[model samples]
Target: MLASPRPIPSQRLSRLWYLGRATGDLAAGLGFKGLIELAQSQAQDRPARIQISPEHARRFAERLSELRGAVMKLGQLMSMDGTDILTPEVAEVLAGLRERATPMPMSQLVEVLTREYGRDWDRRFKRFEFTPVAAASIGQVHRAETHDGHRLALKIQFPGVRASIDSDIANLGLIVRTLGLGPKGIDIRPFLDEARRQLHREADYEAEAKALERYRACLGDDPDLAVPQVHRDLTTPNILAMDLATGVPIDRLAGPEYRRAERDRAATLLMRLTLRELFEFGLVQTDPNFANYLYDRTSGRIVLLDFGAMVPIAPSLITCYRQLARAIIAGDRAGIQAAAIALGYVGAADPQDQVAAMLDLLELAAEPLRSPGVYDFGASDLFERVYRQGRALFHAGVFSAAPAPETMFLHRKFMGSFMLARRLRARVELAQLVPLCL
Candidate 1:
């Protein structure tokens, strides 16, 4: 069910005001809760630990969702970055941003259509649904049918999202710095810059349409994968029109209705596609949000959506990752170290202890690849182990040397695939898949 349509706070002042209010509300809520918990703890002679309750998280998420742009995108990114660096409570709060966003009011939606199609937008479509089929940080997607009887999905960019990208990021940066929301000692500027750049590209429907067409062509009639076709005539700078590809949400396959083999095959296809994106096609859709993928039960094909975050992979980077993978598989520490240096995971000037720690972390991450066969994602403790190691590294300031922005983006996709596999409890022959990529 959709939340009631509320006007998006687009202006800098408006957005800033909302942020300030949300922050105040959160602080007050936490303060009051902490006092109550502290009283109880003192009475019981136990130490008090203040935590962000579910109520507080819901309130924070509601404000961010209403804003629906960089603020919400930042929250989504934090959630995807996982719990290694964040308190579990904070992670839970940001996780809500990944769900549906509050849609623009019908009037606001019509205003955009009028501006784009010039008042007679209704003439072009046989039928247009006012309610969005999907909504996200940058835009909402509506279901519509063309006069020629072609069903289409129209992605409408929010008003002022493109114009406010820089200011939005700048303001969010200020808030993050003031609140110390970032990991201590680590410079998040590179990540912020990369996000700003990606948001700009995402806001441009024209660029997204081109990316969608190119990515679809790259897939080239693969039986197990599907990409929507762009409807060029219906596309605009802010509105993207494409063939409506339908399926159950990709995560739904984790349910009892899906057989173990079906889940395994689906996850395998995603893992293989990730490799192909880097090593073969030289293009990667960096957004790892599960919403971007869908599974057609009847066709048994994965439907890919949202090409806005698609990035071109440099051949050199591809070679570097290939080396990294082979090195991991071969259990060659020296090879892994070399590849890590090449990939900027660690610097030569860094302390030897930090470097060695990073290597340990990398080796742990590659455990699935080292497994003999059919590593069970559902039963694995890799994420927990990784979190513990990562937290240690973070406290030791190992992440202060941020990787190249491109590497960060690619890492997100890789982690996203891993998380999806875990969610489906799919067993994958990662050892076999590594060879094909190599």
Candidate 2:
């Protein structure tokens, strides 16, 4: 079994030590220059295979978990953005950051409880589990029962994570640049700054509680979805309490026993919700981690969790995105180009062939929306096609500007949702669903 991460390093120097250790460990593996050369010479039919040793993966994960703030979040970001660039072995190791990290020891938990709820905090709960049920970068959640016998989940923020956010992010940026993990010619500074801002909001439990409530209201009367109700009396800036919502993890449906209809229903509901979030609610929980979604088999509803990454979308951007989709459906290249430029996806100076390739990639991705009915994700080769185009574009050095954080995050959510659908081999009437959003 993988070892649970040790205590988080709250002090600046302590955190810096953990990062330095991780960078050194990664450096011991295949160097970044080696990776860049391998990628260049890699064959299209059979890509060169290189893997980080298991020891390095474990070591990297451990240090990130120990740091448990912006550093850990950076690991998750690398896992997501490095899919095409990083070797699979390395990506697999980084992907583990998405799951629970080691929980804070009982002493630490008690200290937080005492700080938040006072000396008589034990009296408030009929029973509380000392061990956390789930742990993440900013906090870990415990299961508890109120004196009134109400079952609840308590989210306790790691001490000092909020204060350490800025420094941790700065340290993380330094480590990334030093390792040359970033792709050539792409300025990652805006995205890094955006991440710091987002992490600050996530560390604020009070803000998360409000976003949860707003999201619940936004998803009102949606029979297919469920959001936990916040217990305001028990909530504080560092703590959040809500009903103990129960369900199986959504990924369980990946099993062979799950029928096509059941899988399709889940995917369609998720896609529909995504559209509503973008076009109707104008707000979204941008992190689409499978663990954040639970399937209530009895209720047939998807239980939504983790409101920390929730963000608002600009109305004009949504308009541009919708226009882009409409143009794809209509085969209007000019309209597509106009919308792409408006959305900051293509630069005005990008070469015509490169722009054409980008447009082709966009059109391929939009195929589901353009289909009349039952777009089969199981049989689709769209991902491979898009990957090929994206690889070529990345090497051509024609794309310079990174999309705004808002657009990038929205795309992240969309792509993740689609990936889940593909994993379940879902068949969705996506064309029909697009109309509901408009």
What is the per-residue lDDT of model 2 for residues 1-438, given as tens digits with 9 covering 90 to 100? Answer: 234536667888888998899877766665686566566644452233445675787688777887788788767655653335566677667767776676777778888999999999998989998778788888988899988888999999998889999888788788779867676888888887887888888989999999999999999978889999999999999999998988866766867867777789998999999999988999988886777888887888889999998999888998998898788888899999989989888888888887787888788888898888799987886776776667667777656766676676788788878777876778999999887787
Model 2 lDDT at residue 164 = 95
Candidate 1, 1-438: lDDT as tens digits: 567888888789889988787777667667876768756754543434556666776687788888888888766765663444345677666665675788999899999999999989899989999989877888888999998899999999989888888888888889889977777877889888988998898899999999999998889999999999999998999999999989977877888988999999999999999988988899999988877888998989999999999999888999999999999999889999999999999998889889999999999998989999899998988887876688768766797677788788898899999988987889999899979878
Residue 166 error, candidate 1, Å: 1.5
Best-fitting candidate, scored by lDDT: 1
Q: Which residues of candidate 2, in runs, are more than 4 Å off?
A: 1-5, 26-37, 41-49, 77-96, 349-351
